[model samples]
Structures are given as structure tokens and as C-alpha cells.
Target: MISTEQLAGFRYVQDLQDQPAALAATLDSLEASPAPGDMADGIVRGRFRRVVLTGMGSSFHALGPLHLRLIESGIYSLLVETSELVHYLPALVAPDSLLVVVSQSGESVEVIRLLEAAAGTAPVVAVTNTPSSTLARESQFVVETRAGEEATVSTKTYVASLAALEWLGAVLTGAGVPPVLRVFRSACAGMTEYLSGWPAHVESLTRFLEGVDHIFLVGRGRSLASAGTGGLILKEAAHFPAEGMSSAAFRHGPLEMVRPGLLLCVFAGDLPTIGLNRRLAADVSRGGGKVAWIGNDADLDALRVGVSAVEALPLMEILPVQMISLVLAARAGREPGAFVRLAKVTTIE
Candidate 1:
């Protein structure tokens, strides 16, 4: 059994707990702003030829939902990492383009270079927690997360940014801000309710994954936000190596690794692809693999975080992974959020 001493004085757990309040405050701020429909008229009449969404780390992964949101609305959109956008795809930042840059810290190494390399004509729509950041000051528009100061991993900021981006998407698509705003308004209570049982979540996951040597997180669509960000934090928090992949993409080759030492966690995404995701989990279990299914019906149900309403499910999906990181770090006799080398914000490109 792992000891609590292993994780004593760590700020990661507190950061995760603060997400509900942080997210609620963020949504509240956006809701009080000018109605989104009235604000997005410039983008609708083709004044902006395309949208480029760029960020790094969890910020990049959070773009999964927004990228799909734009495509669903018949808007031209490109999702690129900040580093790659400035270095490899400079052509995408043209006079007619709209760059929506998502970064918790507005001054990451890549974000600084993006400003340096930009054509200076693209209207930057900065979505960040830091209002006074370089990215926010230089942008034509700014959307603040208001997730407050985070000392460890990006628990509060990531979810807040996702909610803010969803608001941005709703505005661009003219989806009516009332419905989406209500969804996020309810998200505050839902998140607190789900996270109230954090100890139970940690115990359940730790017991189930006691002997697991490797883990894989799988999902599609909005759930990709969880799948990708979950894997990165696990490795960062616990120094554990895990892989996150699309549910369909995993079967291509990773299926061969379905065995006792490997744990395959699957997210039952939205209706269209959920059946296929469930089938993949079932097949892996039949092959003697350990599987944890996160959905409405499951052994380890993660839906308790937030019910599937609007875009809040993605916000909910990541909570369990945060708990998993805590338990994993405990098992390794290490402190959560203790970075041996990597800085909170990457300063070097």
C-alpha cells in the first residue's frame, strides 16, 4: 500500500480541486461580456478567410474540441502547435487569417516566437489566463480564462480554457450563447459534486492498477482533450510512460500489447463513435487485457464529473486522470508536481 507521506505538501491535488471554482468564475465572466452573437459579426461575413488555433502541451490538446467545432460549422480552421505554426506554417498567418492562440501562460517559448514571426496583419484572438501577458497585450482581441494562479500542472487553466474556447466556438457558429452558457453554468456544481469523492476515485484506480506497468488512454472527438492531456500529465507527475491514442488508431498496432502489465483506459465518446469505442474495449478485455471504461455505464465511471451536456463532458473527463497521476506518483514513492528538470513554462524553443 502507498503512504500519504509520499504525496505530502504537493500542490497538484489542490490545483485540481480548485478547477470547479475557477471554471465557474471563468464562465461567469464570459457570460457577462457582450453577447457572443453580436460580437462575432466580423468573422461571419468572410472578413477572416481562415482560423488558425495554436498552443503547446495541454493547450494544443484542448484545441481538439474547438477545431471540430469550427469544422462542424463549415468554417475553415487549422489546428497547429505554436512552435510548428511559427516555424513551418508561417504562410497560414496571413492578413486575412484569424489566429486564436490558447496559452495558460501567455508567454511560453513558442508563443514569444510566434509573435516575432507573425505577419503582424492577422488579428490575434488571445485566449489566456494572464491578462497582462505579451500575447494578450499584442492581440486585437482577448479572452481571459480567470483560472487564477496555478503552481503545478494545468488543471484549472486547461478546463477553464476549454470552456472559454467553447464559448468562442458558439459565438463563431452563432449557436446562441444562452444554451452553451447554461451548460457551463451547471458545470460548476457538477464538477464540485464529482470531485467531492476524490479519495474514493483515487483508491479505486490505485487498487485496480496496482500491478500495471504500462497504460494507454483512448478516446475520440472532444474526448481527445482528455486522452492526450491525461497521458502527458501522467508522465510528468509520476515519471511514468503512457500512450494516448484515438480508439481506432490504437487497434492498428498497439493491440498487440494487450496483456496483464498493460492497462487500456477507454472513453465512450459521443453517440456516433461510442459503440465502436466500446467494442474496442471489449475486444481488449477478451484478450486478457485490463480495461477501464469511462462513460455513463462503466466499471470506473467518470461521468460523475459532469453529465454530457454541451461541451462540459471534456471538462469532466480529465478529473479521473488527475487522480490517477496522484496515485501513480504515490506508488512510485515520489511527490506529485515535483519537476526534476522541466520548468512550469517552457522558456526555450
Candidate 2:
């Protein structure tokens, strides 16, 4: 079994190498494009009472942070799965409403159907890794993710999606984009450096995963997005029943299920929320569950830009989780990214 520390470290480095470049490219593209004013002109100026963000899998989880950002800005934004949006929420949309759809491949059938349903009633904005994909072509506006390619699971693409959506948040709220772009650039640099030692970290984490029956991830805000997506990857790649919940929610209920053989991962985002996450980790540990804290001051300097930048924070933090999933899958003797019962593009109604 690999050590817990090694797995944690490796996952961190993997994110660093990939997320930074994607973020830089995303920001550069946004800067060069037609301003949000031109793209959102008629919709924002003349209409649009509500904004709905829709997607599937990791793409769906990416909406968590932006949903909070929108609500904080007084925009009544809704986060719904594309399948659900198509079958049930069609009536909620109209010509004035804005539908933001995120799909890494841009060719998912449900996304395609959702676009068709929103054809004339609302404006569709597609955020996808494939610029030439069908969904991108069908949407009124498209934001391309520069996450390049993935070997199996959604690694860089997930972070790229988050960075892209955060920029959209700034644009929609009329906040200046320059500041966010600068932060993103710095963050990318930090992410790259943080991931440099990923192999070593993965080696450490393997030990804890050796005989674990389940894994639980907890975080809040943007971290919650990470927690959910990370848990999903752990399940898909490692063939484990991994679960994620907001730290607060776990306290309210899920904490009861933790056990000695269980692995619990807590993502501590910023200073304000770190304590809460850490406390949850402690609770899990006290209950005899194996636990780990992904980010702290000791590792923060190693991931910050300049020396290491704050912009790269998310990338650095997210990488370790991805690596853990990858390593666990390899150790479990399973082919990574093999969807046994699910299709790459979910078309179910």
C-alpha cells in the first residue's frame, strides 16, 4: 500500500502541470473576444429575468461555485442537470432567460437536446473544451476551455471549466475582468509548481487506500465543487463508493457513517472555511476513520506564485485528488476511465 502522504502529494502535482496553462489560455481568449457587452447586449439589456446553468458530471459540479457567486450578486441563477432541464424545466425558460451549458466534449446528446429545446425561447451560452463540437455550434455564444486533452478522467478540464465560469461570473456581475485574469495567471503558475512532486505524493496516499471500503470528501463553496467532482472520479476510476458533502452537511448527518476502514478527505479552501473543514477531518479521525487535510500553510508556500501564487491554489489543491483516483484505479487493477454501465455522452431523457 502507498502512504497517504504520497498519494496526496502526487495528486497535487498533477493538477499543477495541467490547470495553469488551461487557465491562462481561457483568460487570454476571453480578453481577445467580443466583450460580454456585445454578446450579452440584447439579453442583458432588454430581457433575461433569470440565468440557468446546466451540465452533467464534473461539468455539473463546476456550477456550484458560480451559483454561489451569482446568488451573492443578486442574480437568481439556477443550477440544473441538462437532462432534467430538458424534461422538466423547459417551461421555466423563455426568450429573455439565459442558459449557460457546460460540457467538456460539447457533443453530449442531452446537451444537444437542451440546446434544441432552448432554440428560440432563450439564449444559450456553451462552455466546452471542443470549440468545433456540436453543442458549441448550436449555442448563441461559446466559451472554449483550453484544458487541451485528457487521458481518461476529467482532470484539467474541470479546473478550466471553473476558471471559465468564474470569469463569466465577473462579467455578468459587471466586475472588472482584469483583476480576475491576473489572479488566474498567478494561480496557474502556482498550480504548475505545486504538481511537480505529484508522483511522490501519490506514493504516500496508496497506503490509506489499500483496503478502504469507502471514501468521503467534504468542503464548502468552491471546495464543495472539488469535493463532489473528486468523489465522483474516485468512484468511477477506483471502483469505490466515494461520497462528498459540504462539511456542514456532513456534520448534520453523514458523519455518523464514518468507520475505521473508511477514508475521509476534507478540502480546506480559504482561511475562513479551513477551520470548519479541519474540524470535520478531526471528527472523522476521532471516530476511527482515516482522514487527510489537502491544503494547509505548510504546503501553501510550495504552491503559491511569485514564489507560488494564490491563483494556482485551486489547481494545486485539485491535482492530488485526481492523482489519488488514478493511482487507486491502477492499484485496483482496473482500466481507468472505463464506464461499465454508463455512456460517455448520457442521452437518457
Candidate 3:
């Protein structure tokens, strides 16, 4: 229940609020038409020498989970941006490579160029919202996200791409994915719950973030999807400067940048790395930096949004950051994601 007073005509805020339905619809569309064609079967069987995942912006970030999952499931995968895949790494688009491309519009310039570069060599599995766009038309296997229309600055499409990629991961890994899908169902409600508390979440996080001269979003594993996208959208939607990097990377040099007005949101992600992230929070605090732990383990009630399972963590993790962007926009007296110069779709590489 976000009021208009807070949005400042920020259409992307509506896009963010549309996520619950968008996710449900995308999941339903995926379930209703769950077939990946013969090329995908070969890739799933590890017949391909390499599997390359390519996209740009949030679409690229959404592939983080699937890329890691494919590697863990014994499928050799490389996560490369479409721009890189098309020009510099065209050799990687070999006959034995399975290319998985994600784009909500499916007509972005990079996607078109990647399709041209990989045309006859690789078997492509395209996950996109548009059924007739270049990516969909050129792909051998299409996994349509069905996120519908997004105005500006990706929100629904980002979540929907993540959902579509999750489904793709399940199909390739042959894992028991009923619980995964169930967790997706829970994610919609989790987001709805968070959005319902939007007024409070915005005010509190804004106040928490007040006087924060710089922002750093850090996370590990799948949470990196949120961390990376969160940091990007804060800049796009709020025009605020933020950096999203790995928790380990932050410790190397950026840790010294921690001073008053510097706020770090550390994702206490999965079990294997959660402890390490928590320790980083402790170390940041000891170094006089403000640290906010995110995840079920976060000590603050405001930061902890209940996620149903680890499968749902990526979807859950971005909600608070979305709130931050809205508040930042309102504070700056601008519409969130109103794009003063940037276009919704990247028409040029």
C-alpha cells in the first residue's frame, strides 16, 4: 500500500509493486509451458563443452544464481555480458557451447548483436519477455519470462528474469524443484508483506540512511544478485552513488573508506558464508563504520524481511533496497526511476 505522496510519480515504484502479480504470472506461464526443446536437453546432459550465460544490466545480474547452480550441478558455465560475448569473446560461441541469453525486451542492441555473432555456431536458450523480439526469433530454445510491460528501471522484469532463470536451473539440474517453486510462491507474499509495510520501511530506512555520504552493498553467492542490482538501481532509481561488491572484495581496500556517513548493507546470505559476512559486519563496526546485516539473522527488525527458504533468498533480499531507492528519490525531489537521460531499453551497445 504505497501512497502517491511517497512515489512522486515514480512509475518504477508501481513496477516494483507490480512484482507480486508479475512473479505469479511468470511462474504460471512457465509452469503452463514448461518445455525446453532438444538443444536444451543436450546441454542439460553436459553434451555441450561450455554453457555461456549472457545479458546486460539487471538481466545480467539475475543470472548469478543460475550460473552458480549450473557449475555446482557439473555443467561448465561462464557468465559473460552480451556485449563481451558478441565482440571480444566471439570465439566462445562455438558449436559445442550452449548460450543462455536473458533480456526482458529481447530487442536490446547487445542481444541482437550476440544473436548475430552466435547465429549458426551455438544453440541458444533465450529467456525473455517478448515472444517476437530478436532474441526470441533467433533462439533455438526460448523461455519466455512473461513479465508483461515495464515502464522504466527494471523491477518486475528483474524478479521475473530471476524466476525464469530459477526455473531454467531446475530444468537443467533435474533437482526436486517443487519446494523451489513453492518458495517462489512464498516470495510473492513476502514481497507483498514488505510492500504493505512500505510507508514504514521507507521512512525508517531513509532515516537510517540519513547523513550516509556513501553506500556499499555486499553479499555472497546468490545474494550477490540482490547486492549488485540493489547498488545499480540506487543509482538509477535514486541517482545516489553506491557500489555493490563481494564481501571479500570490500575487505581488501574499500574497508578503509568506512567513516561516518558510510553505510554498508551486508547480506548474511547462505550458511557456508553467512558467518563470514556477519564477522565482516562486526569488523566494520569496530572500524567505526555503520553496518546493517541483511538476512534472517539480522539483529535489526527493520532490515529482516522473512524469506521462506534459501531458494527464495534472492527474491526476498532486494525488497528493502527497493524501498531505499524510493526514499532517496523522494528526498531528492525527483520521481524514482524517471530516467532523465537513460532509456528503458538499451538500444545501443
Candidate 4:
């Protein structure tokens, strides 16, 4: 079993802790960089007709929030899994097209295939932590995340990817980088503050996981990306069964699965979706399922009385799932991050 302490992975969190300063630097550099019209001396944007975002596994799901940002800005972007993008979406490529591919290691098999498929037609932008990586060498434009490194499941790299892509999203739409930088700063501060309260949350959530057999995570917009990625992390770290889907999709059929042994984790995003998420939690609770609401919609205000924004943010939005996974691991007597079969880099085709 992966130990809870081992799962905590102090160095991983420390690396994540160190990311805010690095991310701030990246934002500063990006601000000094030319606008969308100015990238590649303005020649690249003129030839590209569409932006296709591709990756695999967590790398692919990381593109979810960015896709929402692009669509909201009306910049015409597509988020396709790399395998399908290489085989079916080949026709969408042109010299004018922009394909931004993300990989932590810059070595996923599908990412390599997609790069090959986009070879001549679309100019490639590779976002990676490794500058010497294969993807970086092949890309016409490369955005290095500068996350330093990561261990266990992706902590800093994923956050850095979000920060980097969010900046690019703003650039693609001709928006100032400061606003994006502001949000990243807030998120970082929130996450940093959130970790302090983990010990208590871990203790309290054990009861919720006592007999739960299935867990479902739902979100929409940018929250959806976190919800899905969160689900994957819980599965990977705790060796549990977890499902991530859209909030609307929960209503269509999955809501029926709510029962005494089921757990529903919903991420409350901005505005209307927040209300919808609360209602979903209520729905699950009404059906006798255990419901843990994260984000602003959760009723943690009573417990959150003395918490700071940094501490509150992760508890409200990020740490609950981590706590829940920890609880589940304890109940199953499993170690937190005991990887038996999966390797860090997925080399197989």
C-alpha cells in the first residue's frame, strides 16, 4: 500500500510551492512577448486558419479549460485526443493552422504521431517542461512551462500547464496578460493556503468513505478540466474507481446511480453553474448518496470561519478530493501512491 505520508510527497508539494514565483516570471516574459498578431513576426498567425489542441491522457484533459477559454473568446479552437486528431482530423491542417501540443515529458506516443501528422501543414507549438525534449525540438514555437520537475502524479506540471495555456488563451484573443496573471496568482495562493488544513479534512472525510464503492466527479467549463483531472488523481493515488463527467451529463442518466454507497463530488464554477452544482449535490443527498460539495457552493462557511483565502481555496476547490482519496486509501488499507504497473512515461504505442 502507498503510505499516506508517501502519497503526501513533500517534495512534490514543495515544487508546487515554488511554482508561483516561476509562473510569475513566465507571465512577465509572456507579457513582453509579442501579441498574437506578433508571434513569429506576425507571419504565423496570418497563415493559420484554426487552432487545434491535442494531447493524450491527463495531457489531453488539461486542454479542457483552455478550450473553454478559446471558445468563450471566439478564437476557433478544437480539443482533440491525439490519436483521433492524427487519423481523422488530418484534413483540418493547413500551413495557416496552429496546432498546440502539450506533453509533460514531450514524449507520449500519440503526441509524437500527431506531430508527424501536422508535419507540413500546421505550425506546431509545443508546451513542455523539458526544452531538450523531442516535441520541443520539432515545434516551430515552443512554450516551456519551467515547472522544474514533478513526482508521483502531476502536481506542478498540470498547474503550470494551466497557467501557460491560460496566458496563451488571452494572447490568442488579444487580451492583456495581467488579468490572466491575476487569476493564476489567486489560484496559487489559494492552493498554497489550502494545504495547511489538509490534516483535519483528512480526518473528517474518512467517515464519508467508510463504505462508499463508487465516486463521481462533475463540473463544467474550466471546472470540468479540474474535475476530470481530479478524478484521475484520486484513482491513481488511491487505487479507487472514480468517474468524471459534465454537470449536465450527471442529470441525463448518471444521477440514477446515486445510492447509499455512492459518493458525488461536484466542482462549483462561476455563476449559474455554481447553483446547478449545489442542486446536484442536493439531488444526490436526497437520493441517499453521500455528497461532498467543493468550490463556492459548498457549505463550509461554518468550518471555514478562521481560514485564509489560500487555505480556503484548495479545501473549497482542490483538497477535498485529495482528503477523500486519503480516507479511501485508509479504509482499503492501501498505500496512497503505490504504483505497481504504470510507468511515469507511457512509451508504448
Tens digits of per-residue lDDT for model 3, 146-215: 8879998889989988988988888877775566678898888888877777767777776787777678
Taken over the whole model, the C-alpha lDDT of each candidate is 0.83, 0.73, 0.85, 0.69
**TM-score comparison, 1 vs 4, better candidate:** 1
Q: Write the per-residue lDDT of candidate 4 for residues 1-349, one digit (tens) a residue.
A: 3354654665433543455555555556565655445443333345556688888766777788778767776667788887888778778666766888999999878877777777776788888878898899988878778777666566567767777787777667677778777766665555555556665566566654677898898877766776777788788867889988898999999888888988888776666566877788887899999876676435653123122232112223545665666677767776654566777777777
lDDT of 1 by residue, 1-349 (tens): 3565444456887788888999988988898866434236666888878889999999999988999999988888999999889888889888778888999889998998887766366778889999999999888778899999998688899999998999899888888778887888787787898787777777777788788889899999889889999898999888888888899889999999999888887877778898899899889999989887877676564334446574877887787778888888888878886789988888998
TM-score of 1: 0.95
Q: What is the lDDT of residue 322 in candidate 4?
A: 59
For candidate 1, the clash count comes to 0
lDDT of 2: 0.73
Greater TM-score among 2 and 3 belongs to 3
Which candidate has the top score in lDDT?
3
TM-score of 3: 0.95
Off by over 4 Å in 2: 1-17, 38-46, 298-314, 338-343, 347-349
TM-score to true structure, per model: 0.95, 0.87, 0.95, 0.86
Q: State the lDDT of candidate 2 residue by residue for 222-290, as single tens digits.
A: 777878888888887677788888889888988889887788777767767777777788778889898
Please identify model 3 stretches exceeding 4 Å from their true place: 1-9, 44-46, 299-301
Indicate the worst ten consecutive residues by lDDT in candidate 4.
302-311
